[model samples]
Target chain A: MFKDIADVRGKLGQQQYIASEEIGTVVYLAHSLCKPILAEGPAGVGKTELAKAWALSTGMPLIRLQCYEGLDESKALYEWEYAKQMLYTQLLRDTLRNVLGDVNSLAEAASRLAQEEDVFFSENFLLPRPLLTALTSDEPVVLLIDEIDRADVEFEAFLLEVLSDFQVSVPELGTIHAKHQPMVLLTSNNTRELSEALKRRCLYLHIDYPSQDAELEIVRLKVPDLKPALAQQAVAVVHQLRNMDLRKMPSISETLDWARALVALNASSIDEKTLTNTLTVLLKYETDVQKARRMMGGGDDGGRHGRYNR
Target chain B: MDNRVVEFIRGLRAAGVRVSLAESVDAMHAVESLGITNKEVFRSSLRATLVKEHDDFAAFEELFPLYFGSGGPPLQSAMDDMSPEEQEMMQMALSALSGRMQQLLDWLSSGEGPSKEELEEMARRAGVEWANSPQEGRWVTRRMLQQMGFAQLEEQMQQLYEKLQEMGMSQEAIEKLMGVVEANREALAEQVAQRVGQQIAEQRANRPEDLHGSDLMHKPLQSLTEEDANQLRKEVQRLVMQMRSRAALRRKRGNKGKFDPKSTIRANLRNGGVPIELKFKKKKLKPSLVLICDVSTSMRAVAEFMLRLTYELQDQVARARSFAFNSDMQEISVTLSGRRAADAVTQVLYDIPPGSYATDLGNSLNTFSKKFMDAVDGRTTVVILGDGRNNHNSPRIDLMKDLQRRAKRLVWFNPEPQRQWGTGDSDMLEYYPVCDSVSVVRNLAQLATAVDRLLTER
Candidate 1:
């Protein structure tokens, strides 16, 4: 429904999510240029969800590559189908015997088989991975390269080549350019600095947490069935949780999850008893729970407990 | 621009021939007076504008030839009648220019060429531009010449053509050479111009273009911009005001607390459980600070960093304060101020009545404690700056002990030699002990560590 970058940003802002200008630019790039957006943010902030939303908005299939350390080209881009390769090898062995090929030295036969492109790395045997699949898909696709920072630098180097030119080089199949270049989005959590060479090729944007009112609206949007009082309490409590010195602060997704959990409890107000029972969903860490409990005065529900008791 | 006095001051600042404001102004004046047509006159004017420090002689040597000696200025000049040494330099200038231009051409053609004269010159000086090439392979050099944003090169080229006419090159040949140069220049200039935007984009893309406090504080993402200095000054103001409030509170501690009769009776009632002692512990607000800063030339890119830190401490710390020097010694703690931290710092080194020489830690510690020892007390903590380059400065242990003896805790933070310490002028060895803790502080990471330790102890 959005006409342009401004429109998209305005629409999102109307939803009260407050997409940063950078995020708006990237969303515009992905939608207008039809490039797969690679979103890299810390766990729980909606990097993966952007792809899903794009797919939902456009009615396209969302193809995701959840990147991890040690992921190589075969797993991420493409691989030869091993079963087909073995079948071809068996057929060649049977036919070669009849064709009087066995008289040649085993070395020569092996070399000949290796040299035959069809017998070696062939297109029929090519198992298209997310990158290749995104390129080859007949329909529009959202290829999400998630958590690329965790991927090895070598993988990043490999990705840079594909990103610069939406073409993958296969020694056997020759170069494969995307039939319709999918919208490419690459993300990083900025755990380590990206190389300058790669940075020059792509348009980049960084996403930060939304403001308090925006976050409250997000909770409402995600869980409209939850009581208004409970939603407000959950947002307030989560906002306070974020300010604490916790190892992993509660992210927006946790914010929604805790709201949903609270709503399921049929709690009209967030009493100390209900809070203690449901604290696990909010604070993932034991130390964080302990710290929160200490702030709450050891679950004693002190004299001035009207806010907590609702 | 022609004021000899202003020029002299700027010249000293331009040491190593790094172009400064005075040079730019002079170049602009030369363009205004002589017209851009006389290449030799223009080159001479530009060179004269920039020639300062002894180190700058090399840069001038590189740029002068490229500007004036590039073409048509033959072996036989009116200088042919002058000194033999003058003639040799002219010959060297011509050949160097030709050779450098050829290298620039080759770099443009191959898209990957070793830094020719043009690239190297631009990289060294701020305003000079021979060619700008980054990333996207060689394009038509002529387009680059036209598009490259540097007006200096264009003005210089106009001078070159005008000088060619003066040198008696035929109009036809001049036109042909101009055509060739113009084509290559335009091509290269366009590419370079495009890359200026790309470089800006690349800088933004690689880092968070906007920092959390970017709008408020104005800290630039890459190089330290004027914005960073302004924002730092703003932050320093806020911090100083906050510290002033805290300091005011510290001063009024006892007077603010009048005896409460109800609390006194409550305390006496507690003695019914046989508690006898009624004691009033004075609210002692201790103030101390330790600053360790990076002063290496590379770190000089963020030279304002330490100045800002010192400015912050001037208000934050309640002290009889002490500062020691490195590489060499001077305590300018009294000179440094939070309000004018950056300028005051620059003023101290380059503008103070008695200017500071190269840093020397050994001499500084001995001098500071010996000269300013009366200022340090049980309430004080020592702050030292420099790369800890003892730089052959003697590490007098006895003086360090005497200084350390005056303070409750000695704190030394070295910007280098993180794990590997006590090498070179970093005689962290001599001062490591008399101090309570010594940290090899580098960047924000180390600063965070030092701040943590200071606050935790507090």
Candidate 2:
């Protein structure tokens, strides 16, 4: 457990995640209150990374559930091991016949088979997925539901019921409650609006683009071999690009990658030619690269491309 | 539950942040666990519990300080820094001022204005209870401040500064005092505004639900402001979800797909392959769409909104390819992917500057047929969103016929009234024969109805 908000920052810092005061405070309260934290922002701002850092800092086993469209309960929560159950029934067919061999009436024999139905539906045949694993774990864990916005709205309904109570009901084995309620962190890219009912049960944390100084620190920490001045220049350029209203703003990890790429190339300065060569590392979209080059001025070869030529 | 936190939640709600009762309860729980001794934690506790959307983060940041910050200016008073002899001289100079100025100086020097009750009374007297909206709250606060003599109070502070100079106080001392006085006056004005805002929020919280949906659906798209557009974006998202759930229920009721042997065997596992109960697959009813929109100035709002709705419902459709044009066309399917529809609209609208709008649907259709002819197939439903005023250009009826031939069906949503069709340059009459359906979609209700027909008639 965190001693205080600052302790959260300190512990997470040791794990190499530089948390802002808001992030630290939210993490602290999430631990104390035992509410899920719905961390949302633009991609690559470390919404997922923060969850990882928290789990590491707290020494909790991390269980991640990656969400996509049409995500459903059988995949996320639990699934019946039908093949295993079927194989068991086949192997035990003669043994079952022996138990029912002395039955006089057909009705009594059917009842005897009915009494043994629980053997297949029991916990041995229930394969626990991330949600059920996190809930049923003996020790506390950090359940990270990554990119939850990508999941269908119906999946959110399944979640709304499960999150309100840290328990899952299997018809044969009854309700399996959490021995230690796992700290849940759900990250979103803000691509789709999450239902308000789900938000109501969770603590909401919005992580935007970090401050310039923070980015500088992050770059230096991640790519220690990079020159200090080049790191500063890279952070400054990222800040400038963030305000250009481009399709995709460069995220923190992109900045770090740029720094690392610059180091790998043994580059000491961030000049126009160097930036053009390394721009692809920062921006994924060809249009975004052109826009960044256009904004950087001195419209070089990258900016002269016909489609987005200014 | 803390009263102050409750009041802050009310302020957030009235500010349109939509903090629900469950969120407020969570906020109180967070605050209790975190404790209020650390102000940053306290703030984060409230924010994490109450604000769930990035759009509301700014409002929370703005209102948090106003609710939780200490009631004092950031400036320090010169009197605190002054020697006893100099302070006495300054005191005498302020005391020499008479009536309202003297009383004002006394309050400013004390670093406290009228108490909460007094401020509330003044705002009540300013009719803040009658101020229903935040804009009206601003008006009431301004009036309340003026009535409280804040305007004259500025002049009084100026007079005091002159008196200090006349009384032989140092120039530096006088400047320092001025900073404190200005800061106090600004703080006093803010207090009035905050109190008025709170009262209005209190009144709003009592009256309940937001005014949404019905009127907005009937209101024409062109008249909606940016805020209304944002609200409508949420409405569209909700509409898609509602329509999806309803579709799901309908499917669950009667619709069945291919037979599944595995599920049938599993159902009759107890009876050794004696299949009594059977199972059928859930039908996948997703449709593919091709949306071509005229984003000229007159049709821009309608086009933007139509594209926004299409993008929100993209999940329901197996595939959606969108294009925007004024005098030229660009395939925006890539631009609109993996982004919020509202944000994507801004980018698309930015790329296609409204300044060069010529409403040349004829030219755009030619561009589409030449460059994007492969996008349409036998199963595609090509929907055109426009007002159909083609700026006196060629109608290009041959291209429209070709598109209708390639597509499963071509539907047109013309916002212009039927009487206005082909009156001047509109190609609606010419394009009507080629289209499978032409629906008037001036407002959201009509637009939704048209879209519903497009989906259901499939």
**Maximum-DockQ candidate:** 2
C-alpha RMSD of each candidate structure in angstroms: 26.3, 4.5
All candidates: TM-score of chain A: 0.83, 0.93
The candidate 1 chain A region of ten consecutive residues with least summed lDDT is A301-310
Writing each residue's lDDT as its tens digit, candidate 1 over B204-248 gives 223422433435333332244554544445454444444444444
Question: Is model 1 an incorrect, acceptable, medium or high docking prediction?
Answer: incorrect
Q: List the residue pairs that clash in candidate 2.
A: none
lDDT of 2 by residue, B144-190 (tens): 87766777886787778788788788898778778887787777777
Worst 10 residues of 1 chain B by lDDT: B71-80
Task: Say which candidate scores most in TM-score.
Answer: 2
**What is the Å distance of residue A126 in model 2 from its true position?**
1.9
